[model samples]
Target: MATLNRRRFLALSGLSAMGAWLGTASVLAAERDAAGLLPRNLWTSPRFASSPFTVGVASGDPTPDGAVLWTRLAPQPLEFGSGMPPRPLLVHWEVAADPQMRQVVQHGASLAHPELGHAVHVELAGLLPARPYWYRFSVADHHSAVGMTRTLPAADAPVDLLRFAVAGCQHYEEGHFTAWRHIAEEPLDFVFHYGDYIYEGASQPGVRSMNGRPFTNLRNHVGEQTYTLDDYRRRYAQYKTDPDLQAAHAAAPWFVTFDDHEVDNNWAGAQDQDGTPSEVFLLRRAQAFQAYYENMPLRRSALPRNGHMQLYRRARFGRLMDLHVLDTRQYRSRQVPIADRTQVESPARSIVGAGQEQWLFDGLADRAPRWHTIAHQVSLGNYAREKDGVIVSSDDQWSGYLDSRRRLLEHIQRTGQGNVVTACGDAHRHYASDLVQDNRDSGIISSEFLATSITSGADGQGEDEFARNTLRHSPHLRAVTDKRGYVLCEVTDKHWIGDMKILDQVMQPGGTLSRWRRYAVEHGRPGLQEA
Candidate 1:
């Protein structure tokens, strides 16, 4: 396998012709007008039809010579419940060493079935590893925008850098994905989506779309409103339609995990507190898990069976980075009561379950990479009461499971693990913290970076005060921002930098993004600091 820098890779691939081949801004505007997918016609014909390609194209699970490519086709647009004919379309994929693809490396075909809502995932193999690659998809006469992807380095290879993005909690009804658009413009090897990819439950009545229309439900509400395969699939399809999300997906490969929104808000392992029977919730979970698998570019082994999903996995980027993706939603105890939030601190209350805990510990113990990253959903750091009067434990967070969090942090501290940085989502706000093991005590420590929502919350206005107050109350917290955006990370052998990119407003289609803050973790420092 060979490695090349961005300039050489682009020069070799002929990406300079992207504007001409992919379509010019003017031409896309014409296409958008002809297609009518955007409101008020930002541009006619936009590059791809105004379809859900919004979640974009992404590749993940990169191996030495192969990677998994993903994209969901939205030919029917966003008119939910209008059962469009399930067309079995032939989708073509191509990977190139150069942007021009003059140096085509791999090419293949995948079936985009309407039954699966045209979501197509192709796992391409036999390519060079530790190298950069460009890819694109074509269905019928329509061609997807070009995307960037990379393969992991050889298991024992000495790696110099590993760049990636981390984000989650995108509520379509909350705001636009301008932040995603900005992220798409940056260079990234892959992305880690830490759950809340879509809010499976109904949108709150007062929520409004970018166009001021009341938020629409992707599915017609029914029953206790969950545990159905169709319901999950429809929700995913609806989310897949966002153009900004599509652009982000098209920009790089992604590693993902689910939090509460992927199923129901605050849903713990096999536990539904909404008066639903345990059996019914479990069945619904199975359906949701299966639907999630079908939509994601996941390997067959990770697929769900008998209503259970295995989300814990590992991905290595040469010797530069080792990402331990955790399944916090599965194999965990239920949320504790607000009053007894501190009382629920029991080791028996597992977030990743016993098996997953072992897996994570083992991965960390190996210490094979320059950087160790935990792509887990939700905050791992403590978020206790900010003031005496405020009620703090939102059982869904690590705050409720203090014992479990301590055990994991203690493991990292005891092992003397270096660069053990955690990437998380769920709080709907961007945060940077020095994950001290004994946050209440001074001797123990670790580091974590929590990303803001892609669109969830009211334009990034969810519980921001609580987060700010929590940060102020806890010295371990480095920074906090209640903004709608994502986190961009640039990892190298010597250091890892996390950039919080914030959008002005998500309620509109296109907004500006400004850097809120930046933090850095040195090669051997298990903590974060101002960059």
Candidate 2:
């Protein structure tokens, strides 16, 4: 793969009329073809009869000397009661510094039991930090597809540069994953998926499924929705089979969290916005959380139990970066009704909950890094507006929890913390804003870079127009786009740059990508500027 040179990229784009620059779509297509050098027929065929491993391999939660590698034993995957045989099977895993797995670094055995859904999570330790590793799993004589992963840098190392991508909101029935196909080709250290990994309900009418296939429900969702353990597991299995998503997972390790759609849209705590009891809802939450943990390469410590999962955690990338991941949906207050948008500003309402708020403040105040990145679910900027004497508030974002947002901003400013950049994914549009101490105030404390959806909402209702209008109204906002794609960020000692990659189209196949905009934040300056 070729490295992206900012200077050359800018020069070529400036002369795009001369045909000196290739569009992102063509370049990405070429890269994808190159990466899949193996014959398509050979790659897709079943490698084993009874212990088939259909889903490709993946890894995450990387440490300096280790990382977790993952795979599922789909002996007869997707068929009813066919994912695994009734008997226990032994699975072998290996890690190496190279793709061919010649120089083995770690090897282990994990028993695939029917009780745990026949999935494997192998955590490997004692590897080098800031280095790439390759791994795969084997059942009997058949080997799973090879996967690539990497570890974070040491806590105090002075790193020169760090590269990563952030995206969320992939509704499987809405569109093809051409964006993921493109992102899989980028040379990135890791991928941060901010939430809404899969939609709980089956495909609604008017939503387009990938590869011209109908949106088939694999889980036969109970109550005509997804809530039970069987329902949740089936939904995950359906999503895990996507070729584009699988490719992206194989490309790099991922850090993930969930928003409401993982269970239901706009659900909070034990009561939804409608003020109804959530006893059944809580039971559903437990099953969904468990299924999520079973599929991802998360540590066992983050497992779900009795309808609750501990997802708020931190990751350090040498001395250059510290990532504070947030789980906004699990412990948040009830969603304010549409009629009570003004009432949401009350301090009683919480987004991260009171306890989690203190945890975040303590983490931010404890140590100073070149960049303090927050991996959060919803948009933090105030996106409310008024037109024709009528007020409109997004019931789904941090705007619905105004007091918590204010407290977070005040804490950062009061502590004099610099370079606090938030990487968000929930709203289906891309946004870059300077989060001021006060939106109307002249003083700015930090900034935010929001990425668009991976493949959600079938191009988002009027999102492009909304983004343009938002930029015009808010002077702090640098740029906005409704295109479907992800954000690739590169952080250096003195500056942090965001590349907004926009897809050509989401409702169709073979969509291409292009750098829609570029913005950079200088040291000690919270505002953004076009690069």
Candidate 3:
């Protein structure tokens, strides 16, 4: 490794982010082994470290040729500063063609800056498409565990099959992450964690007891609601230390987006549920955003800038699928009271914002692939509950943004588009619904499959009155279940199959899992059918 100039290192840190790449685009454009791309002075320091890869390694935002590799140096994951001093560390990384890690393809050294929680994000370019790559991190002689990631198929190539898992809403204190452990064992090409990776609340005790031990006595959040950067960082560290969550990350590359719990419960665009002043909440939001970016294996494009983050982006899997990942919370109107939500269906009400909505429209207008799937945080279909024999719209979901929802469905119907499906999270229970212009008989414009929580709802009953009443009032909802698990999706040219994997219990270790239900949406078809 080469030496780094302290002055130049400090200068680069002050630059602003422009777009897909960071402000240091010039450095990223250089050759793989180019010196100064990352500060290397820390490699020779008397304070050089060992065992820095305590938080494990992760990779995400895979493209046709490459992906982003992530790892944070933390020997003491729960401690302040993660047991590192206020300085950068020289972190070496590599990409290999095989799991044995012998056929090295790409290798480089980068700085794990203390400003970013001693985390190193290495974005690699110029690798083969539609193939798996293995990666790992090293700080001096201490090596991190190997992680596997795969690049998407070439944009124009024809793809035959793609398999992945969809999951989210993992509250740490609720129960063990048995769902993620099972998901790790599946043969998946990728994973979708659609928000709520960490809940933004103080831990609850005695409310949940597993294996005869009360949760209050087991573990809890380190502080009050996360209001500072340190609070959010420590909270994330606590959740990331879970062995099962780590195992799922090590299994395959992940594509992630955030929901309410990531920052605060039911926060909408610059507004907190409890009405904290915008100026004050913006600072909290900034801290939460930074912590989220530091921990996840996200590309620089998703990095936080000036109290905001860009999360919505597009990914492709050859000609078989085009995924439009959305950010529903960042640019949406505040949640309205149930009585007023239905009346506020004006064109001004937006869930995806104008720019992102236009992007979605343009993507749909273009010649599309066999499957058009929207990966978002909330349910798109109408989910009603029976209150005194009256069905009411859910204000927190898409139903509240009535005009936008209608326009989206109308656009699909006008274009005669087919095979449009949505993979959703946030709701703790599993729900499968058909998206239509109005009622179920109005014709299905799209389909939605909601993945249940990983551990947010501990030891959930397989069936409950909530499910029974929801199904009774909402005809479009094909299936509903109260369980903790994920949804496995298999996409082929002719059919898209979804398997709802439900866990019997999350309160204990080694919870048993089973396929609760299976649904299929055929090519040129809009709604889901029993597989």
Candidate 3 wrong stretches, greater than 4 Å: 1-43, 46-50, 208-218, 341-343, 439-441
Report the C-alpha lDDT of model 3 over 176-220, residue by residue, as the tens digit.
899999988998889999999998888665655643434442357
What ordering of candidates by TM-score runs from best to worst?
A: 3, 2, 1
TM-score per candidate, chains pooled: 0.81, 0.85, 0.91
Query: Which portions of model 2 miss their true places by more than 4 Å?
Result: 1-51, 206-224, 273-276, 338-342, 438-442, 459-463
Query: What global local distance difference test value does model 3 have?
Result: 0.82
| Candidate lDDT values, in order | 0.70, 0.74, 0.82
lDDT of 2 by residue, 42-101 (tens): 122234555466767788888887777778777555664445544445466777889899
Ranking by lDDT: 3, 2, 1
Best by TM-score: 3
| RMSD (Cα, Å) of model 1 | 10.7
Model 3 lDDT at residue 300: 72
Judged by whole-model lDDT over C-alpha atoms, candidate 2 comes out at 0.74
Which has the better lDDT: candidate 1, or candidate 3? Answer: 3
What local lDDT score does residue 28 receive in model 2, on the 0 to 100 scale?
31
